[model samples]
Target: MGDTRGISGIGDADDIGDMGGIGDAGQVGDTGLSDGPGQAGDAGGADDAARAEDAGRADGSSGGETLGGRDALLARAVRLRESGHREEARTLLLTLSERCPDDAEVAYQTAWVHDTLGLEAEALPHYVRAIQLPGLSDDDRRGALLGLGSTYRILGKYPEAVATLRDASAEYPDDGALRAFLAMALYNTGRSRDAMEILLHQLATTSQDPEIARYRPAIEHYATDLDATV
Candidate 1:
């Protein structure tokens, strides 16, 4: 569930199937998206582990109602997903989305479910809706961006992915994950200069984080020359 954008969750061009959610379990405004489907790629937002470890809440920032019933249902769904009961979780989320179609959180969760299940085609529109909706939390918003942007990359919609990831970066300037995804999109779209620049920026800024720092050399290599890569 993911990225600088999920505005709410998001990931890389290579499957980015590494699905997951953000925050502690049962936390307020959680995207409630998670539980890995054992897919091939490691590209996705927050991740199944994040969703399993963290609970989701209503879209508090977006003004979606944070009623007790909704919270309970969301928590249950999260548990189900975490426990590898993805279909059950998806079923619950679908019901929730139907009951509250305009609820950005619900839409976001629905998108997450589809994304987790490898239904990138199905997940796209819901991610768009969640992102467009006003009452989303920053995490959810970024996650939506992550989901939407990542899905765009998966569909080979490089321009759309670039635009979406750039929009996400504008909002989440410091998000390394989003930047990496953006780099891939840019590279794919023949915007290697922009891609390398962003990658360099990410390396410079995220050097303190071990996970991100490891990508520095690769980024440097990628940035130094685009034609060679092509």
Candidate 2:
């Protein structure tokens, strides 16, 4: 089998400073003047309010900065990978992941780049993180599942490979690539008969070759009953 790496709200707060002690009837030391809405206490309260507003703005800006250019960067990384500049793509994706650590797309793309570079071990954690994290697009989710399962198989984790690929195949029952990978994993786990059934079924359904097309009915029949005498 070919080892192909398939890669694809907030709220505000309120002022709790007592509004310059509006209810306080007592005066300061001996000045005989009660604190009011615009006194020193009130000024301090205003300063606090201003500081809070400034903090809120800073937080908003910081959030924007975190993900501001992430899409552009991700696209550039993808372009680099597609163009066969895998090393450069890996570096760019690494930087993007660091900047957008919680970003699902960043995590997925990072894993894919590592896979293309033959760094399956390094790709493992990113794949796990991307799958666990939410907001992943449907296409990327499919790719991530296939990549994770294939990587597990490559690493000799046959059981994990089978389980992951089985789940993926269930989720995407019509995905031939997933079935192909799952069949390989099944063979690795000594289920060669089951594996052949899946491969034969896939070939019968998806192949366009004239020879296979001519024999499609036999292939489909044998796929389910490999030992059938008739």
Candidate 3:
């Protein structure tokens, strides 16, 4: 329920292949993989407040090793987002995106930073661009798709959300949570039958998962109300 939704996991480059499920608190799906928001940098303090701190640091320094550069930029973006200086963060990310055009991580983080700042429209292209980058692991691609789908849902672009989620679900067929998100997207799009099917599949496969069970009521409500509402 935080500003950034959870996704899969995060680790070094070698672990990208095995990364699955959504990220922990403060993490959001970036490439269908679970990654914490501002994963490459410090993420202390409360949401907006932490972002402000990061922005301050980003503005102060720009020299470092490769990892240091990424971390510094990420810190700046988070801080700018926290401080409600979304335009500044966007500008900073734009520069980074240009500098690292081939780096999917940079594009993914840029898109997510924008999403966190509530600029869904602005975030979409970056997500798409990141996903298209070569050498991106499946987990990363999945995370990006999930992020894009969720952003679309927030923008009331339900059909796009459904499509994007469907694509992700196909890639990660065993992920019940991914299916659940897809169901939610479908429900939002007035696709009650499809949504119910996805929900049923998720429930059948994850009967013991309290998280999955938590969605039953909402799914049921959507099913029953389909005709009258959506």
Candidate with maximal lDDT: 2
lDDT of 1 at 162: 90
Number of backbone-clashing residue pairs for each candidate, in the order shown: 45, 0, 23
Rank all candidate structures by their lDDT, best first, as comma-separated numbers. 2, 1, 3
lDDT per residue for candidate 1 within 39-142, as digits (tens), equals 31331322432332333222222221234334444555554555566677677677667657787887887788788888888889889988888788877777
Q: What is the TM-score of each candidate against the true structure?
A: 0.63, 0.71, 0.56
How high is the CA lDDT of each candidate model? Answer: 0.63, 0.68, 0.60
List residue ranges in candidate 2 displaced over 4 A.
1-60, 63-65
Q: Can you write out model 2's per-residue Cα lDDT over 30-75, one digit (the tens) per residue?
A: 1112223223222232232233333334435332123323443455
Off by over 4 Å in 3: 1-91, 209-230
Instruction: Indicate the worst ten consecutive residues by lDDT in candidate 1.
Output: 7-16
The superposed Cα distance between candidate 1 and the true structure at residue 143, in angstroms, equals 1.4
Instruction: State, as a TM-score between 0 and 1, how close model 2 is to the true structure.
Output: 0.71
For model 3, state the Cα shift of residue 172 in Å: 0.7
Model 2 scores worst on lDDT over the 10 consecutive residues at: 9-18
User: How well is each residue in 33-103 modelled by candidate 3, as lDDT tens digits?
Assistant: 22334442333223323332343344463222234344444445545555566665566567667657777
